[model samples]
Target chain A: MMKTKTKIPEYTSPLIEQIYEGISQNTFDFVANRMQLALRISEAIKAKNWSQKQFAEMMGKRPSEVSRWLSGTHNFTTDTLWHIEQVLDIRLLAETNQESTPIFEADRLRKFVLQEVNNALEKYLSSRKLVSA
Target chain B: MKFKIVKLSRFSGNKSSLYSVIIDGEQETLFDTFIRNNVSENLHEVEQIFATLNSIGKKVGANDIFFRKKKEGKAGDGVEAIYDYPSAKLRLYCIRYGSVTLVLGDGGEKKVRAWQDDEQLSKAANEMIKISQILTQAIRDGDLSWDGNDFVGQFEFNDNDEDED
Candidate 1:
């Protein structure tokens, strides 16, 4: 009996490797993760019913450049990130738990109180006018 | 000073009840006065809105005044000035201004229209301006912090076999 040898295909994961390499080179494991971040942003743009052309116009770039970004073919620069944040009108990266837990809670509570006060005032004024007439 | 509400039904849709005031021969848009009077705890919202508007090619002149293009009018002329805070979906427009403010709402149609005669517009505008000032300072001073995602840290996992060698 003769034994047959099987050939295995050689595959290099360029995208995966790029992400790994980018992560390894970072001082604190930040930056260079733009490829993954871009995917999230692209998803958000679609969810918001915004087109690449509109986003490009907002960023003052041509539609082709935006196309490249969405395709993940282009490495994003810091300037581009800033522009994206501006155009999307969202904070892509916020300090992780930077504020004390209590402080954050207090801020939330304050907002609620203010909203209630405004609502009450509005209601009172409306009723007062109705009564006068 | 004595004040009167100039009906703005001609400009905005019938659903919108818009009015302005005339004071001392000067017109102060109600929306503008509201922003000028209100104080905001979170200036971040205001800053973000202004930046978004500015990025979208909205015209902003000195004093942070944003002008919206008139549907049909001559160049450099607009029927309204809109201050939009996109984060809150809150927008205020100045139809006319004098001693009393005549504010209109294009964003929060129902809420803003209901408070056409209230002083809330002035308070909200003031708060918005305060927030804008803080945002401007943050940008100018570079006090804005970048998200942690920008910095990457690495760890090496050494195998026991490699250590034995």
Candidate 2:
């Protein structure tokens, strides 16, 4: 039954085109974030050498519920994510403001550099105006 | 019943190949049918599922955690399901060949708790399982062969299920 390579049909249609582009960007972002959270939870569980069921017990959720949560479509609340972080001791969300974290200092430094650059540009513009005068 | 295994171009990427089945006499693929039926009531769930599919097809590899993993996977024939979990409003069944290839099948609102409880959902899942078996047999018999990204020796599937198109 082996024959020469045949072309597989590309199943693109108008409806598919509409659906692919029709969905809102917000929906896509929500899905991507959910997937990332699910992956992070799975990874944390794996790193701890614990099965999903064990992780579920630690999180005080049913194994079935945990499985559903990892299906990449869960509308996770901030409370649930925080709980997961506590149970797994894994950081899923970045700190908005934490003085001890290196990111905070780096962000501060970046802001200072931007302000300095703006001041230097203002001085250069004033000098140029005076020279033209 | 007869169907054609068609690869979806928009979702296909370097990471994985997304496929769909077009029943004989149908104008669009099974995945299209799922989207058309649920566009009005379950638009958000539909969009989320589409986003997940697009991600799996492009950026992220088709990891098992992203899906129900195996509604019929105990058979070990790649029969799986995908949906925006917790909502469980709609479920799309498919056949996965490892993480590289997937054949999207049509789905219906899983109003009941189990697919077996709802006749329509059962039919959708079962149809994909039948397709999975047929495709596996075709590869074994040399009617279809792996051509890198997808099976390319033949697109035709002479499945004998008495299901409606």
Candidate 3:
């Protein structure tokens, strides 16, 4: 509890507030990715004019779960991120598909295989049309 | 508990005035309690929270994009919990008065799957809810109002009676 009916102190700068100077690169990256991702997701949700409840339904999650995601507390799994990407139509894991330094080998290969299959289908359809003509 | 709101210079800026709650009979504000409890145990998350606060205070002006709206849809301007998104074990709850004013409450580690399962977090969040109600009533009565940076008029409220009733 606080003091009884006392005047609140005038705003005073903290005396010698020690900042987190010399943050390690690893920690920086870790924190940055989490914060940025959370912000991006929240922003996207707001842009689409969906409340957490609506977004949660879209992701097939409980509203509480989506609240945690935006709270920056949810340690989003790759699967959850993928689900979010699908629902929001945003590339949260875009870095994973980078041409250089690909993060997820299996996922990148899956995309590559899908592209190849689509290209083959297109080629076959075009050749059939040419032969018929 | 009755409390007074005070502006914190460390987290304050031209764009926004960050505030903390100091409950009656207590020496520390909720923000102070938050730092005292977690500054040693979870320095990394503490730093991350500080960075977020810095961005909110200095850059973003406590926008909704920076806060997680308490999905409860309960009143108090929809109390929000402070988090850095990508990772956090700690959670600081707050009520954002638009973009320029943020009132911070105490926080602790989320030891369970949901914050409602965590006593400390629930208390902190509940406190914010109460504060939000008080603030909303105050604004409605014109007892308090935001003046860009700091609050003008009566910023203090006694809610012990209401709590008892």
Top candidate when judged by DockQ against the true structure: 2
Candidate 1, residue B142: lDDT: 44
> Which residue runs does candidate 2 get wrong by more than 4 Å?
A1-4, A77-89, A98-133, B69-77, B142-148, B159-165
Q: Residue pairs in steric clash, candidate 2?
A: none
> Tens-digit lDDT track for model 2 on A1-133?
2233568978788766755666556556767777777777888889999999998899888998898887676777888888998988988777768558689889999986786576546535543443343
Q: Rate the local accuracy (lDDT) of all candidates.
A: 0.37, 0.76, 0.69
User: Candidate 3: misplaced stretches above 4 Å?
Assistant: A1-9, A12-16, A19-133, B71-77, B161-165
Per-candidate iRMSD: 26.4, 13.1, 16.7
Best of the two (1, 3) by DockQ: 3
Residue B147 of model 2, lDDT score: 64
- What would the per-residue lDDT of candidate 1 be over residues A1-133, giving only the tens digit for each residue? 1111222111223321222222212211222133346556776687779887887787788986665575322556777777788777767665666756888899999986786576546535543443343
Q: Count the backbone clashes (under 3 Å) in each candidate.
A: 28, 0, 10
RMSD of each candidate relative to the true structure: 28.5, 12.4, 16.6
Give DockQ: model 1: 0.01
Off by over 4 Å in 1: A1-94, A97-123, A130-133, B1-65, B83-165
